[model samples]
Target: MNSRFDPSPAAVPPRGQLLLVSICLALYLLFCLQQIVLPFRFFGMTLSLGSVTMLGCMLAISAGSLVRHGVPSELVRPLLAILMCIAALSASVLASNHIGLACAFAVRYATSLLALWAMLSLAAACPRWPRAATLAALIAVWFNLALAGAVWFQWPGALRVALAFHPEETFKYLPRISGMYEHPALLATSAAMVLLLVLRLQQRGEVGRISLALALVGAVLALALTQVRNTLLPVGVLMAWWAWPRSCTSNRQRHIARVALGGIAVLAVFVLWLRYPDMTSAAQENMMTAFTLGRTYLWSGALDAWREHPWFGLGAGVFQFMVPDYTGGRFHRGELHAHNLLLAALSETGLFGLLAGLALIFALWRPLLRIAAERQWAIAWLILVLGLSTFDFYFPFFPFSMHAALAVASLHAGHCAPSQADGVSRSTT
Candidate 1:
């Protein structure tokens, strides 16, 4: 396999390929900054310029792939899985009480799949695509961190600019800084993912020691400012896992220690839950309630909705609307989602949709495993992203889902050849 950091002349991408990769990377950076960019409503869905541009780029890439070479054999399973997921979501839409909302969600899901396909195709076309993407992600994350700092320090005109680009009205009421994103949790998760990528690149000798140190410090600052405990918890765990010295202990000992620690953590959490009332002075101020932001109530409501429609679900995007009905208006207005990916999936698509989702993950198992072997930190980044989704919506959201797809495609591209690898007998580009 040709490594992006390979010093051989043949490993270097050609000038044209470099230019193309740079352009795509630039567009991706814009996509990362979508929240701050001006947006327009299209059929009741808000569309950012960055998203439209990226979509156009993806369409162009897809078209070029069709004309140059047919779909790669390696992608057959993944494409089928995506189609199955879309079909399941469409079925849920049919069962939804709010047809328009469900349809919109279904369309977004389709778009996300298209973006994934385009990324994989691009990776096949450009061997250096993954390296370029890593650099772009790092730069974009640092830029957002800088913006967050500006907002924090009350820089001139920063607040005004942030307000103008802010999508949610409730943002003005909150003290947390979201930077260019719709929510602080989103920014925090994105930062964590990028930080992991940076660490991986450094481990592979693609980044310098100074760069790695700077990234670590910047990531810590950003996480502190975001104050998102969900993201913070996973990040803390990952950092500790990575920082632990491995030379002193055998692999078996390490594994045993990790297992023991995990058991202890679970037991502690159970005890806390059991004695939460006695531990807190008031119900509203309890650690569980504060940590979850009262999401336990919302989760219960979602479970109620799921119980009512255990099979097909309420539909692709009906959960938010039905929140008031299920929660008795306790979580009405600006709540937007179930705030948890699995709960949202269960409440909106039910068992059928959940099964389709699982199938999609299973289909990508090979690529994910390949990534784990070649770039372990990428898998860690993926895990962190999923962990964040447990506390907030990431999969159902636009750009965030696209971001994950890009990472997977880039990593898969790095490990496989454009042709002859993974059963591809012909050029996929």
Candidate 2:
């Protein structure tokens, strides 16, 4: 078959473009590792070298796209949506008790949104970008595993140096190995995301059998070590969703089997709960207190704040300070933002902000649907995002959220213009 007509060959992208994209991805990976690996700050500023690199990459991609394509038409609606979300969230700052802190957080949120927009635009322009992105994510999975091994083996030099730069509280008491992230949950969520990506890549023949096996094992290990139930549950659901159809011989059988399995699982859980009511209650209580009442107290505080200011709610960054007040003085911790994404939006920005967020998600949904027929994994990624967001904040501005945006863009854009995947035209630049 002619290389141009071969979908597999066309999807690999040109060597030159791949190299450039890989360099950018490498820098982005460094940004992910800045906390524990290369903690070099740019000048005397608080911004790390990785942050500067990421900023530079975003600026360069934006500038090049403007010169070549003059702002993609596909980006118009998403950009408008982003602007509305930012405006809505920023407006809540007016109602904030600590105006200064709220304003700072608002600014940070706005910046992250714009950065996300730029990344999506870049991905839409280059269809093969997701290939590089998957490889990058795999590398991150391995890097984290290496770090975990370092900690477990007590490699004096490596462990000592990495821990020296880590936050004291993160490792001072808790023995959980966070690896490259500041928190174990963060690491677990990221690993879970990568696991899905690796599986998809393998399905598409973009990854080898050996590589896929290693990545899945590493990602699973990371999740187990982190012990984050919130992430583990979602990953389990996604894995089941991914494997169900493959396990059946036909669509009808697949549907029937899925329904049967789901019913059985639910019934079993119900039976267990009924049989061991006290045990179930004790387990729930223990999980809640695992991390000083875990997310229950934080969620309670968020709901209380939202009820107090239902319309506009408390201002951005206000939840941390008002935790004690909202939680009936039970939570005295400082700087504790809402752990749940929906609650964060409702409590900090209120109805208007929540609506704007929905609008943004709706805007992105179009392209995602457009690619769904060819790239089902994109929908799986979306499911993971929403599922994880219910327990932890993964919307609008987390690093993982930004990466998700990039991955989705790559999938949508690649399907939209398969002809350009081989870098046949300068327009892709």
Candidate 3:
């Protein structure tokens, strides 16, 4: 019936507010370019333009938030401080390389995590901007889908080559499109994230039913073209969970049943693995196989690194250096990350970082549950975040992670009152 687009930001905000909205929108557009790697010298250090813009926005928003709204009552600041302290400690004490490398790693770690918190705080400051955030996320989705559609229909190689980190490998597969990201899996993940944002907007009545249906169709088509299975499993689960009948069931019972269902699914997979060992071989050959594909070596090396430094683990972004020692140069070669979020946390920052991460998740959990209880479609976005991170490491990829953070910020502030999302009793400004 009616379009769900909110024009309040344009209609109500004063000149300064309008400027802030325009700046945010422009930054999101740059971030959505996903393929572009415009690097320049910034204070003697090389950095991507997109990353610098995002970081600057985060710092500015956080500073303005502190000034207008006072400090957030949420655990964002203290958790951030703890993470930085641990990163500094790990860099100095447990790093396996030169001091400079350790310092660089720590800086990267802080910047990445801080970007996430910055989005959260920005949402807290501007509670009415979830519609804007959703629009930005949708733009990213459309950009990715258009590029992927072109690649699937035998588009010229020159166009595809521009979007990939490795131009030589861009055309290795006939119809498998990588969209604007480095890998097909990354494109799939980013697209799935965009779909989640769309679904969230629909839940808040910010998207029409017909538009939602068409968006879902387009997103799934793009995901299939990417040929990435990691993105499929979670999206499938989200659909099933969203469509699951909830009548006559108590909340506690539903929670228990969900846990049981998860366990059953895991066991069923294990049984299938034992029954058909040949599937393992097939899995190794295909990169889409979730468990196989020589990831054990990666996981093993990660565990070994964790055992070496149990508390803080190896240092931030040091998984590559330590994993090689355990992989014997077999599977770890040229692999920059642990490929799994929890493993990356364990291997890089160890238990301390993992705990901090959990704390951060817990901070977001309350609002998430509140929203999910009211709107089942809302859970999919959070599931998309966990699902991608579980199967692949997107935390260090600033473009993807920044978009994810935007979705989370929108969700965190979407259903709750302004005071509730900020975890404050009253608005200060």
Candidate 4:
């Protein structure tokens, strides 16, 4: 019984719960992007209810805990703002051009945001959780990578057997990766994220580092082989953060590595784009097209939406609805989501909403800034670049935004770890 616990000033979590949530949020968005392309038939419904349930459970548990334990801080303001934003979203749907679809979107958004809020709050406040959270994320990535490998290796034969029953398609067929996901790019994206997180954990000397490292290397190799350019940014972002945490690792060497890696990344991207001319086309673009970062069409649509409604904007998930009505003939036939985060906000929530949302990031990020000032470089790097990778709608449908927000929040919450006796040193999940 050597383990002693205290919640006094000497042992408390500082409230950086949002940090873990942010990274998870990034993974969550990556997950959502993949989920959008499924054409499956489940009881005549193609949509995945699994995602809906997951987010719902997150929100429910968080809300339940909050009710049971209670919290007193300015943090509650953001939660209230999120709730109000959701309410405003409901109002927008009530006035939406397509009430039915908008309502569906609203349900999706509300549940996601609520879950995100709870997860971030809880992650920060919980005394014994950082390792558990890290483990949970690792498990998700590992599972996805395993599934992708199985699908990639088996797709050709599986397709042939399935095609024998319905050989009446004009579309060309190819055996590609699909992991546990509906699409190959998403699978690759998942692998890429897992690879980075695993590497970080390994670097930090977490358990299973070597095995996970080997697995991570394989995943990264496969991810690159898949050639999804959209997949590159997150991986690239993580690497930069991994290697670029202040002057901790000799600035001269770090600069050389950054330049070398940046140059190599650029060269690789150029080669892939050359091989696949029509980047957005499913067949023409190399598996590498998924990693490319030209999301102008979606961004413009978001801008047009913002121009129309700058105050409360189109109301959360209503951006998808606004996509068709606002921007015309510029993008793909049925594409939703602005590829860029800034553009998505400008289009969906407008100036005010975007500011409110970003303000949350800054508020949470400020503590990390202080940590960085004290030379806590890796953590700071994570914060600055988290939002740089993808455009996360404040929409509940996109889990990444909340993940990012919550992770940052958790880290900040953890700063007051004195209340838990020795805080970080004594904490476990």
Candidate 5:
């Protein structure tokens, strides 16, 4: 196959394809900038320019794909259907408690679904566009890493501008960095996803290998600087998974080696723990304190809500309203994401929502398993990120979830065209 850059004129992507590329790029920009383009009120509903842009592009691409392709793949329809069901179910369940919050949750969920469908359509409709999307992701990673480096080192010019952009939240975890995201974790999530994407692109021969290798290193460093423990899990898993095959012989051998490596890592930590017992104790205590953050009480409350609304959840986005009652108003100050996707789903949408969430996860991961192991790493990366969501939530947010779904969709697209020789294919089995 011709390189992504050397496509012939006829191979040039259509305007709608270009729009897809633009949407991917704009999402990254919006996530990093942390500033909504505009804000307004309509019939007592608040809206933003960023939201309008996202929705408009998604609608345009979805409509375009429908006309051009006569409905998206069977896979896309089910995924969208599942998402819509979850959102609608949640909104309907919670409408009575607070219509405004329910509407907000519904809107967020809808945007997420739109983004998913848009990315999937873009990838499926224009084979050329994934390369561009991957490239855009790489560019965003590079820019963010630079900005994060500046913030990490306290560069005066960067700090001044970054602070001016979102003083209250950006770099709030100072000495740590957010890199234009509202928090360090969000930045880490974005970088980690992009790193996996670059790696996938490199494997596919879509991007230069050396440049992406460097970008991967840069992304890893930036992720570390963010100091987000949960996000680190996925990235760490990705690195180890990538490195595992390089050092081992056969499948069985690799499995044994991975276990051995994990054992060694655990033992090393144990030794360090013994060597610095007091420090270890203090660190453990602090971690536990931070991790709890009234999560126990909150989780218990969620369980109570789940029991009461056994079939459906208390309604999507109702957890925030119920938290006050659960914790006696102790932990109601911060965001109400539940810090765990499962718990949030259970509390917000009950058993049905949880099942739908699981199905969605299955849809994302199942296809990758049928492909080669090296290709499987992309989905592995996603699985780890989703696993991390069990400890901390980000995927529910539109940009984060959209990027994730895109990665999954790209993998599925790649799987469907396994004959195409790309960078990873040559390098892998």
Candidate 6:
């Protein structure tokens, strides 16, 4: 019920080309797993395998796509803005208190921003979007293996995540979750997005019921492990979408099913509320705590950083660097992120970066709305993503939305003809 229901991008190059896609996927998975499973820490610096893999994939994929088709100007603007923002952040760090540490993170930030855009430009106009989408789903499942393993390990990942986070009092406790993501918020957001894909598979009545069931159970467990309250909003959106009553009278109703998922959700919330009265406040403080407090604190910190360097506050990777200064000389404090995607640019790269991001988001809206109006299964997919982004960074969330962009491109390119996903011409031969 949520995403733009466009299947225009559901193309496959050819069975022969799947091999190329698979090799790329294998490399990406290795990076995600290495970052989490083996988390490297040395010389008081962390060089995560995940970020490396992420950046590497972005670069490789962007190159592959550009080689296939020249880079479009529409894509280049935002990408350059982000890069410039990173550069500014790096420069600001040199002026900061710790040149060494800021430099380290600056490198990391530079890598992430580049990798993100590369993937975006590369996939934005590719063909056979569904084939690419299918590949993405598999990768998501691979990443989610961590959540499954944690569930099997009998570890209360949910609790571990809560305790790990500052401004303490989170009490979410779910055992054996998280395939590899170290942070609960990251885990929750990713799980939510993957779950939407599984739901898409399940809706298709294709070869996805059993697999989707497994993915859903694992995703829920992982979300619990994250103990992230933000999961509620995205999950809530899904529930509402599911609950919207089916207008049996409307011709479009048969095209989609609006189950009373929200009612079920309300019932569940009521049950949880009932438990609160019988238990200590600590028993469920995770749910009791204000959900947006941490995000608010980080955003507030970002604002302070902006004020100091109104032009380009801090540096791209300088959020943490700027925190102490913003705190009025307090040392060793909590970290900060723009939290909201657009604001991240505003605070980190000043108005320049922020405008670029907004332009991209605006660019996406037209196509997104067109797809949404189509009311296809994919539309449901996008809605869930929308919910997921509220809590986590989804803007240029890459792998998650790459296929979506391709689908939009396919629609406009006639890739999704009434006849085929490949936009091929029929041959009697």
Error of 5 at 199 (Å): 1.5
Q: lDDT scores for all predictions?
A: 0.67, 0.64, 0.61, 0.50, 0.62, 0.49
**lDDT value, residue 404 of candidate 4:** 46
lDDT of 2 at 281: 51
Best by lDDT: 1
Q: Which runs of model 6 end up more than 4 angstroms from their true locations?
A: 1-25, 33-46, 72-110, 120-126, 129-176, 198-215, 238-260, 263-295, 321-339, 370-429
Model 3, 141: alpha-carbon shift in Å? 1.7
lDDT of 3: 0.61
TM-score of each: 0.79, 0.77, 0.74, 0.66, 0.76, 0.64
After superposition on all CA atoms, what RMSD does each candidate show versus the true structure? 6.1, 6.7, 6.8, 9.3, 7.7, 8.4
Could you tell me the lDDT of residue 147 within candidate 6?
38
Top candidate on TM-score is: 1
How many residue pairs clash in all the candidates, one count each?
0, 0, 0, 68, 7, 31
* lDDT, candidate 1, 1-429, per-residue tens: 112345433334467646754766677666554554444575476766656666777788778865665556666677678878888888888887777788877776777877887777767767567666766666666777777668778899876766543565626634556777777766767766666666665655665655556666666655556655666566546545644556633565456447644643554465346445445644557667755767887888888999999987888878887788888788775366787878888898898888888877776656666544554545566567667777777775554776677666766674434453342433423
Off by over 4 Å in 4: 1-48, 72-74, 77-81, 84-88, 155-176, 182-185, 211-215, 234-246, 250-275, 279-294, 321-327, 330-333, 372-413, 416-429
Model 6, 1-429: lDDT tens per residue?
A: 223333222322355546655765665455454324235653357655555666666677666655554445434444445655565656556564456655665566566566545544534554333434444555555555553454456467633432222113212333323444444555555655655554554444322344555656655555554445555665666655544655422434433324324433553465345444433443354533344544555666677777666665455555655656655544344344556654565566666556554555455444444554334444555566556655555433334344344333322332222223121211110
Question: lDDT (0-100) at residue 358 of candidate 1?
Answer: 80
Please provide, for model 2 over 213-304, each residue's C-alpha lDDT reduced to its tens digit, 9 standing for 90 to 100. Answer: 67767766776566555675565566567547563235764564466446435543543443354445546768555433357878987988
Per-residue lDDT over 1-33 for candidate 5, one digit per residue giving the tens place of the 0 to 100 score:
123443433334467756766776777565434
Taking the tens digit of each residue's C-alpha lDDT, what string does model 4 give over 239-275?
5764675546666646744874685497457547654
Ranking by TM-score, best first?
1, 2, 5, 3, 4, 6
Candidate 5: where is the Cα deviation over 4 Å? 1-27, 30-34, 37-39, 42-46, 76-80, 83-96, 149-167, 238-287, 290-294, 371-375, 414-429
Candidate with the larger lDDT of 3 and 4: 3
